[model samples]
Target: MLTSSNANKKRTPNRLSQHLDVLLFSRTRLEGIKQRRAMWTDKQRGIRLSQHELLCKNSCGYYGNPAWQGFCSKCWRERVRPAEARRLDTRESGEVTTPTFSKFEEKKNMEKGRRINTMRRLFWGGPSPPKQPSDSQMNALKAFQKLEPGDFTGFLKTLRSPSCQRLQSRCTAFLNTMEAYHALQVQKQSDLVQDFYQSFAEYFTSFSEAELTRTMEHVEKLIMTRLHKWVFCHDSCDDEQKDLTLQRRIRSLNWVTPQMLSVPFPEMQSTITGDPFLPAITAIIEMDAKRAPQDKLVCVSKCSQHVFEALSTSNSEPANADDFLSALVYVVLKANPPRLHSNMQYVIRFGLPQSLMAGESGYYFTNLSCAVAFIEKLDGRSLNLSPEEFEGYMRRGRAPAAASGVQAAACETRHLLDELMSRQERLDHGVDALNVQLQTWVQAVHAQIDQATSQLALVQEEVTDISLSASSSTSSDSAEIEHLILTDEHVGSPDTDC
Candidate 1:
């Protein structure tokens, strides 16, 4: 029993010793694993910190871990940006800085070398630099790089110079010339309008009394045809041939005085003996006998007596013999007597200007030439009066029997003046309307200029505001750089160094 117990004790001690050996081996394996993990972690952290320090030093001339670095990434980026920008600027400008051999004298040597090289390249093309420039070369290159007058810089300078007052004067002169030209054009237009009126007058005035009678007959026929069409509703007419016959008849009709048509019998002799009306009537008869004795006489004694009585009773003066003779001529020449009265009244009311009356007489034939001369100066084809022919006509004097011709001329003159006045009134109305339109156009131009000026002012204000804002931002950035420098100086020292 003792041997069995001793064997059990020995087995137990060996099992316990095996258990302790397993525990100790397991603990040692765990410690070795922890040591390897710590070594790997330390190596990785060291590598990261070293990489960060290298990057910072190269980029910003400073070195440290990223988190505890003296300078921030933003600050480092800002500092490097200016250096890169300066390098790029130098490269673009074709200017390179040479390295200095000695740090103590670096700046002085670099500056001297730069100046010498620049001067050498400027004055000499050969390998050896020239000692001095020739007179011509010096003069030529002295101002070569400078902006001259009429160049971009010079132009900008002149724009701001007081000498620019000359531009305002030039603009004023141009405006004056434009206004003068406009006035001359207006005068030319006025002359044209007047010439048109005068030519219209001469066209009618040149017609003989026989021609006047024919024209009136033609117009009357046209009026009659139109009236027939309106009353009878016929679109076609055979009146053209009949109108020509009527016109021929009207032209053939002779002008005669009232006295030739109103020879009184013995019953009317008592009123006519030594009477005032007798003298006027006798004058008309004698004038008619001298001028146109072959003309037919129509005795309307009762009408003649009534006309004389009406003239005597009315306060208005008796018609002059010349006027009476013209009236007698008009009545005899008309184809349709009833329409003649109204037409005659229209002719007398507005067509009795003395200048036109004088132009019709052989004595005042020079005035007709003047009218023709004026018309020839116009540009239109409607009426072309040759100035040479008009002057020739004026140089020649009047015919022998001027007085008798004057009476007939005055009647024709009245008709021409009436037609011209009507045309002139129409032209005046057209000119007034055109003036109104021109005024409107001028107003519109002024308004457009005003609007453009206002918009330009607004745009200039916006540009000015933007430029000021940019300048303020630049100043703020400069202030930030100074602040960063101050912060670096304070933070880089020891805790008690501030």
Candidate 2:
């Protein structure tokens, strides 16, 4: 029993040591795995940070974002703060400095910065300052704020301007009339609008025709700019439904081509040959970006001008009105601009009657409306294509196999096809010319061979006639010559003399 106890005690220490070693090994492995996992996580985090890091464009040594125009948040705050805030800050410093000549220069600098920053905030994205009214209605209310008592010059200027308090009052009155009509569920808003314009003209009776026309235009802009949000593409109206239908129609017709529309677009060899239609297309696209009727009309005019410029540059003769309209149609198709129908209706309904009914601006706007109308009713017959072909193209959609290319190239497959067609035409022409020349040469050789055969036949006939005549006279002539020679020899013989 004592020996057994000694052996058991010895085995107990060995077993404990083995258990401790296994536990230590397992812990060490777990720690190593955790360390490796932590290293990998940190590496991934560093890669993500490096990939997405954007330094402030103002060199402020901080991160930036597009919402702040590539500026850090701190820089954006400084940029958007009004200059008056800076003045207030200086005044609140509570210590009056000694007056110096440089004080005048400092004040001038402050005013300059104030004007610049105000202009910047007005044009760029930022909160509006007190002096600049961001809203059209607000502008009208504040127009008189800059005036002093008995400032006749300022009053007259304000009265003459579109932002005049008088015009705003008239607009507000008209707006109330519209709201009353809306509340009464009246459908004669058009008549009310026309009556309002007539009253507007009465208010400016002393102005010249041109000045009145211009003022009316500005008034239309102010009224429409305010009315646009309330009325444009409203759910209560059919404009939204029309917009959806037109968008879907345009999407389905994405495979349309210039040829399909008979647009007579210039056949360009390379896309890099200056995209003449780019400006026109861009203008057409920007039509959706504007809110007011006048602004949209201006976009239409710009598109028209760009289209005309492209047409004039491409053709030897000046582009006619028909060509301009056709090119405009093609531009609309290519751009497939969104909300085209709604925009056209908006301009037609709310645009100034004087502007829409007269001048080149009116003419261009009319043509654009016509182009949209044509597009709305377009079909295979309109494009002069068979229904089957049109449907086939529609089925193939915009990314047709015949027109596929890398997006970066910016060249359409149709342009490449057009170039290939031209090259093939030149090749065919050369082949035709070569075939004509070969036929002519072959004919000339054949004629020369016929002449040579006739000459050979004539020479053979002459030789046959000479041979027949010689055969007929040969025997008699030979016999007579032999007799004559014998007689002469007998007379001259020496034996006969002896």
Candidate 3:
């Protein structure tokens, strides 16, 4: 009984030890899981804190982005958007509301406003508001007050005349109409401008078609000249920026050669003294000088014609559309016309649909636009040149020029080299001519020698035949005479024997 009790006590200690180990293992696992879960929660909180620090401006307690204008995305879409819609509706109903434009949009609108004011200043021929009138404006104001404003030989005088008040009033009404369209975010501004022109003709029915047409042109010039700044690329963010960017890019690419662009004309490749497309380049540059869309289009057409003429002279076959476009691209790059973006936008805004969209002028202008686009995007891949070569050329363009004295010396050397090359080319042509003449003379001499040899051989053959014939005849006669003599001898012998 004492031994059994001792054994039971030993078993109890072992059982207690095993049970304690299982409890410890379970507690450690639970602690480990809790630690892992806490770490995951802390990591997620860190991410959320970082996001909130950068994106949340109002501390809205929810995840949002700066793109939603500093408000949480959900709040912006739900609460703020509804409020904005209500405000817009109220403003549209003729309640005065201050516009809230983004920084970029505000700047754009301010610049446009400044442009329009400049035109107004010019039209008034005086300082802007809050200033005394200039001499020109004083004269116009005096004319305006007169009951019977006399003959207006000048446009400025005509604008101030009482008889022309109707015109001024109508222009103001038309401007208001255009402003309404602009506010409404109309897409087809060109079509709207067209409708305005058609309405102008109908409104001025008192004048003949020719007179009305002339008046309409005047009205158009007056309005669009003032309106251009407001409407030109109004909402488009990229238009002016693209122009400036392209201007810089093209300036960098001034070092680019016609060969690099793979101009289709061979003469353009070979000629060193002058480029064949100089006239086309000049015409393209002249496009900037004109203000009217039609005049600018005319310049484009003239440039295209020059390109076509050059292409035709260079190649035997007629130039295809692709060839024309390629040549035009080369011309535009070389010309690098000024204010290219403004000119294109003006044409797009004011040009007649029939003329600018469908006719020959339209085709030429489209090609010009394409050329400008191509120039803007020009790169090594576009020109089929290695990136290294393109970068090297661009670097050279960016490099500063040498000293004047060195440049002068270099110019002199280039002139001398050109003269030498020209003289060499002339000498080459002379040598080629001489070689052709020499070949002709050699061929004629060979022909004559052959003829003389054939004649000599025929004479020798005739002489030999005549000699053989005479010798044969002589031999036959000799044989016959010998036979006769033998016969005579035989007869004489027979007589003697008898």
Candidate 4:
């Protein structure tokens, strides 16, 4: 009994020791779990504090960024926006409206938008910008007001009075001269415009420089086309053509006369010099050359006395007959800017002036011969040669035929060159168009090929899949057949019972 009790004690102590160790282990595990939990809580608190510092309520620090971290689902209510803020603002603003504009307003807005877009493009470093207004366009604008006021065609048909017959006869003579000259020299109106400017510098004297420029612009706009037509393709025998020419010329004359006049003069139709006025100018100068300055019988304007006075003075002496003739040429051109392109303007402006002013000199009259004489007249110097020598010298002026020949040759050459250039341009345009079409066709073909290739690839993939599926089915069938055969063999064996 004592031994058994001692054995029980030993067993008891061993079991208790085992239980104590288990309890101690359990307590230690519980303490470790508690400590780990506390540490996890502390780490979470620090993370939360950092998040609170960096983020907007329930959000990561980043916002409005394109990256995925711009929003965090767990950390932000912003991740699932209800659209309420946007909806409320829109709702409070009432229904949406579209504004409309008048044509002028639309144009203004369009211009404003264009300017804004242009400025923005400049800021960004874009391509070349729109063209600004040029000098010619501004000149046109300045002249537009003056041009707007006239219905000149209406006013010109009222000039058929019997009292105006003498003036009308002179006009007829001037027109005849112009027609004859045009039939002689095929002058262009553009060349004639330049000639007109040279013929009478007084055209510019009436207006300020700016106003003159505008006036010139007006002439180019209004008068140039009619003048050009008259120069190139006039046919006055055709009454229709004659009427049109008359009307245009009359209108042009009306506009031009006021501008071409010397200060004291009024209108051209009521000129003080009349009857045989147009032809009288040349004859008067010839008569003057025949007589002395005091006895010179030239019927000139009152203002023309100034030129005579200057000529009669002892300070300057003209070297040759040409210089003496220059005074006359200046006087004639100043007196009237003739309606005739070739007759009056050409004769006074180019023909007679060149013959009169030209001599062997430094700049202008560079290569010309001289007719010499020895006498004293108006302008202090004069030629004392016989009328025959003077007449021969005057008659032996710049040959019209040579000038016409050169001009015709030049016009023909220019026309031919223009035709060739035009043909070449057409061919180049054709080639470029063909090239664009070829490239477009090739690109279309390539696209078709790419599409076909993709279709083929899809078909091939489908075929492959079909092939694999067939192979898989075949293998399954073969395995099933083999298993069935083996089962049959087992069933059919002699020692099948075992």
RMSD of each: 64.4, 27.3, 21.3, 50.1
| Per-residue alpha-carbon lDDT of candidate 2 for residues 125-159, written as tens digits (9 for 90 to 100) | 23342243336535543554445543445545766
Per-prediction TM-score to the true structure, in the order listed: 0.19, 0.47, 0.42, 0.20
What pairs collide in candidate 4?
58-75, 58-76, 311-379
Candidate 1 lDDT over residue span 437-466, tens digit each: 999999999999999999999999999999
Query: lDDT at 234 for candidate 4?
Result: 35
- The total of clashing pairs for model 2 equals 0
The positional error of residue 297 in candidate 4, measured at the CA in angstroms, is 66
Error of 4 at 446 (Å): 2.8
What clash count goes with each model? 0, 0, 0, 3
TM-score of 1: 0.19
Q: Candidate 4 residues 228-310, lDDT tens each?
A: 33443334224344434433432322221111111122222332322122333443344222111111112222223443443
Model 1: which residue pairs collide? none
Query: What is the Å distance of residue 332 in model 4 from its true position?
Result: 44
Segments in model 1 whose C-alpha atoms lie over 4 Å from true places: 1-408, 491-498
List per-prediction Cα lDDT, in the order shown. 0.38, 0.65, 0.64, 0.38
- The 10-residue segment of model 4 with minimum total lDDT is 367-376
